[model samples]
Target: MNTLKRTLALVATLAMTATAFASCGDEKKESTPKEEPTTTATPEDTTAPEETTAEPDNGDEIDASVKTGGDTFTIAAWNHDDVPYLIAQWKGLSFDTVVEDLADNKVDGIKFIDMNVGGGQAAEKYDQLFNEGSDLDVYFCEADWALKYINDDSKTLALSKLGLGDSKFTNIYNYTDEIGKDQNGVRKGISWQAAAGGFAYRADLAEEYLGVKSPDEMDAKIGNWENFVAAAKEVSEKSSGGVALADTLGGLWQAFACGRTQPWVVDNKLVIDDFCKNFADTAKELWDCGGVTKNSQWTDEWTAAGVSGNCMGYFVSTWGFGGFFLDAAGGENGAQYGKWAVCQGPTPFYWGGTWIVVNPETDNGEEARDFIISATSDEAQMSAYAKAKPEYVNNSQVMDDLIAGDTVFNPTVSGNFKDGQNYFKKLAENAKSIDFKGLITPYDSTIKGNFADAVKENYLDGNKSWDETVEAFKDKVAESVPDLEWDD
Candidate 1:
């Protein structure tokens, strides 16, 4: 097929596949108050105007008309599972500290509103809160959700206007330039945590079976995809096909497919470039080498394989490493504790992290901004980190502290937590943000469905040739993002 025709065919295939699995539903809601436009200013200066009124001494005494009660700052977030680290800390602290701290500071209340939404429901809930002008103070959303909210002009409050502009978050901007700026060079969102992507392995197994003594040596053996494959083969051979490198396909695909040039789509066109193909091919090869497990269920497969000590390692996000794997290793339900380690993979990729945004319609816009700044400040960030180390963003000092003080060991590598942190930090330095405009088209849900099916067909179904898989991806993209175009 000619290149243009080939590309078009691929897009069509992906589009059809994506739509098949797309969820059809809207998010539910809890009632609140109406919102009024606080103030407006030029994009150049986003902070709100200073208040002439003296700060209230009693958090409860603040003007109810403006602030949402000193005791009541609602946090809109997805499922309780999304922020495990935060949940752990909050639960461990008995939930009183969050309230008492706010009250003691003369702040009224704090409420964590769980918006049990997932997949497409998440997107819908986000719109309801921001687009529809619902009354919410703080929004906790993933990168994809954050991208959509920030682009919608009416929904979000610009951080710069809250006096957090350039000065307060300089360190965040410097660490990852992508999060600090929007498409228009405007600062829209701030990362609350950094999702450093890497490989988590069974260190005890490596040492026992493969004679791998340390993380540095193991990392050297599987430094990149090519090396990783070789190491996987060694592990498989050593273990007599008892332990594979990964249990699922999605994690590995994400690790290598994400690129710096652009998102999965560009200008309404699907982008099925070398990156995607390479990732698919790598996965295919690993499957062939008996380096991957065959279970399709994520949590179940992860639990069974992890606890059984049946896999060499798996690709995971930084937070995932801390929350999921850590629990698997140490918790009562955990079976792999003290047997794992972490290492950076071939490419730098981020899976999940949240951003906190303000509503422009809130009456206490200035106060809201200050609150955001304080919450994300170095002091607060460090405190949050101390309580829950989920690879958070903001304040380089806090990140440094977490990395330096971490002692958790990864099962994949033969070293302690510090070694894994260094590897993850290095990968984070090269990580890039997802460009919402480029990747998420009107048919985003459809595209995701098609892509998921295509992956299943190519990987699970009878062996498909590389060319055939590429052709399928191209067709899928064309169908899902018909208006999308690729720049020559």
Candidate 2:
């Protein structure tokens, strides 16, 4: 059978079972406010105008040794490599040329300083830095830590005051109402880039054994959670004991759970909506089908699985395609180069991203804002950095270059670089703006650790019933947010 025919068969089987057996146990009991479905099929406009190739500006005239008013602009970031990209684009030019063009259009003497902080020590180090009155001008915060930084007020700059609260970087700020904006319409940080989630599977394996071709067809067969697991079961049966995918039940559970809800906690009562139950049951089914690895035993399994070609691709964040997945596959694994591709998962869910914020206490506030404007402008600097690094563009227009360029691979849809970009666009459309107030408390580590442990024990081990697990989750939420009130 051809890939198309097999996929059609799988879809037919799933559609038949969906009405009777696939209803999610925890879907919203109260009808979720209807919004036009965002992920429906749309016609492709593949022909876009080419981007202008302006001459590169390497900072030359301004003396590198000259100090402007004893002002040193310090930027705190987890990725230290971005500093080089900034310097390469704008180093010695006059404040007008560098700051105005690159930074937000200010002309002031400011010495650039970049700090490298590891991701593991993010919150602790940031807190210490803020408390000690470090002369930091800019900082990057992850999704979970964004609320902590914004709520503290004194630790960071109020972007509204700095004039960056209304940036025009459509992709980064495009979904502000949903992801980046606070309850009071305060824009604390701008999403600099994103790592979208999609299914990466072996095209050759699917073609030869399973018979799958186009992503649209794949969507029919394995689009949502119910169909995805059913397809995995069929793949497992066909492979005869070989792992269908390279993920553990915990990892799969997290992806599905996160995808199903607005956020993990809403109004403080651990959201036990039908989606949650559906996600848990999906994990249970995968576990029963021998489709998952244990959390403790995936390292060697992942390594061997990648090299052996027996396993199908696993769920991957967009950034992981370049950073983690490519690195693990040894960067251009000969014949495996074009064999892998991406497809939309059951639902749109974001995995990872970083937001950049300016510090209000800085003496060079104007200069800092200028720098931010230039760095984040829809111009080439931001686009180039995204291209060179394993980073996704926060600017929608930067995607033009990405789609036109040959370097970035689109594993979901073969021969279509726009595949990932389209996926993110849809995700942004469907996403509900989650309130981050109680999700990341001051004691972030403790909260995350406890939640991770509970998820592993209850879902992975199958030790607790759904009701019991939800009750435990509620207790954990109460421990974190003592004053939280649910609408009940």
Candidate 3:
């Protein structure tokens, strides 16, 4: 038989066998923590909810042998490598290894392509590829757009279809599994990193302004929105109005939106829940106190806030800590390099994550499956991941051991950063508190952007009242999702 034809037959056989194991009890969903402030679920709600590993024997556990006879396969994602620490730490023994092993002809004739969908164009390209059915064999689905893909089985296939036992994931974090699964508890994707977030603050500024720079003391000060505002007032008073409490207005919204009590669209109706309304109030108060500037996120000004000491800090997740935000915080040797600390500021909110998914349309499912398992589930690879880099990995057991200092991933004190404090402890605590089980919607990207714009224009800059701002918001959301229904 031809190689392509044989590949299809094998994948079909594997899918059938995987479905036979579908009844595994470990598929039981984790109950969303009732006390979580980020989301209040009603069963049908879809909530929108990182990591590295090196390979010692990952190939052994997952049988990471490359399938030689399949058609050339393509995987699309936002960057060259979303998580560099993992790739760097692995030193060529991971998904990278699998691809290398195959590309080097150690295997057979499989063609692997890493489609670098530029950061700004990823969502557009992903949607385009699905619409055109352009051989999207493997792809990464981000948290904001995950629900859309999960619900569309045309694009995603359930992992249980591989007949892999839940035993493979006993150590996985409940939230990771929860997000990857559809409403029926069948997982279609998986992540290797836990992108838990906290307030990344200038420890020096905390002491200079709040009179205490340590996380514990600072945590007490900006523990909640009210306390945060009070601290902002202190900043305005002390910095002679030179520094704002937060880096930008966008930072405040980033933290606030995660604390939302319900999805933007609940039950086919556009409802503004308590959390949404509270943002208006909180933003207004911040404006009054000079707590936040109008700078947008990802802009030069916003990035400069962390470095210039013009603002106290940023609300960034573990990914930000490992790359983006940390890089923005003046790299490892920048001025203020060692003056940073993180804490659970006011809520348990996840900023970002990338889920590994397979395109059901591919003739390479078997190979795709092995890649997913190697990157996300292989124990040896995950274990080596911790020692190579300091990431809040997704495996609960792995994270627990890492938290207890099981790996060589050490927090450096050379520069006296946070006084050599281990920030992973706080990261683990914050990661566990997340419970956005049914509060996700695919349109979050649109709604979140519109809402932020509405607030910035009407309330912050134009002097519109909260009610007027809500009216503007409704007009905007209605335009974006014309089919959506909202209550008066």
Query: What lDDT does candidate 3 reach at residue 255?
Result: 64
By lDDT: ranked, best first: 3, 1, 2
TM-score of 3: 0.78
Q: Model 3, 259-368: lDDT tens per residue?
A: 65456665666666556666777888888777886667767877777777787777777666655566556777787787888887766666667787777666665666
- Per-residue lDDT for 60-125 in model 1, tens only? 232333333343555566765433334334334434344444324332344555667664366568
Return the top candidate by lDDT.
3
Per-residue lDDT value at 269 in model 3:
62
Q: Candidate 2: worst 10 consecutive residues by lDDT?
A: 12-21
Candidate 2: residue 44 lDDT (0-100): 20
* Superposed Cα deviation of residue 226, candidate 3 (Å): 1.1
lDDT against the true structure, each candidate: 0.52, 0.49, 0.63
Clash count in backbone of candidate 2 = 23
lDDT of 2: 0.49
lDDT score of residue 229 within candidate 3 = 81
